[model samples]
Target: MFEELRIPTLWITKVRGENTVEPTRLAPLMQYIVDKTDKDTAVIIEGIEYLILENGFETVFKFLTNLKDNLLAKMRC
Candidate 1:
């Protein structure tokens, strides 16, 4: 699906392989993208249940909250 849309995708997984990001590292990765991209960016997260299973609801919630805050901060600039 991402290939058809021509959108680059990164896998959030514990598996050690190419184009894979661990759940713990997702926040920093997203922050980097938000910081570097000049154009509007659309982020589609598909595996909330999986992330919750791996990192609990609170952790995922904090991650999302931080991402939202970062995006908003960027927008204000």
Candidate 2:
């Protein structure tokens, strides 16, 4: 569906291997996106269930909390 629309996209995965980001690296990756995003930017985070299964809910929760904090901080500025 996304491919047919010609919108640029990235698929982050651990299994099936190509174009994958390590599960452990999600936080830093999100931080990078937050740092680089412009006013028109949009981000889609897929696979939360998978991430939680891979990294544990506690770690995923912390990552999301930090990411939210960072975004909120940026928004305030």
lDDT winner: 1
lDDT of each: 0.76, 0.72
C-alpha TM-score for every candidate: 0.75, 0.68
Off by over 4 Å in 2: 1-8, 15-20
**In candidate 1, which residue pairs get closer than 3 Å at backbone N, Cα or C atoms, i.e. clash?**
none
> On residues 1-77, what C-alpha lDDT tens digit does candidate 1 reach at each position?
77897767778888978767887786666766576454477777888998888889998888888878887787778
RMSD of each: 2.3, 3.0
Model 1 residue runs over 4 Å out of place are 4-6, 32-39
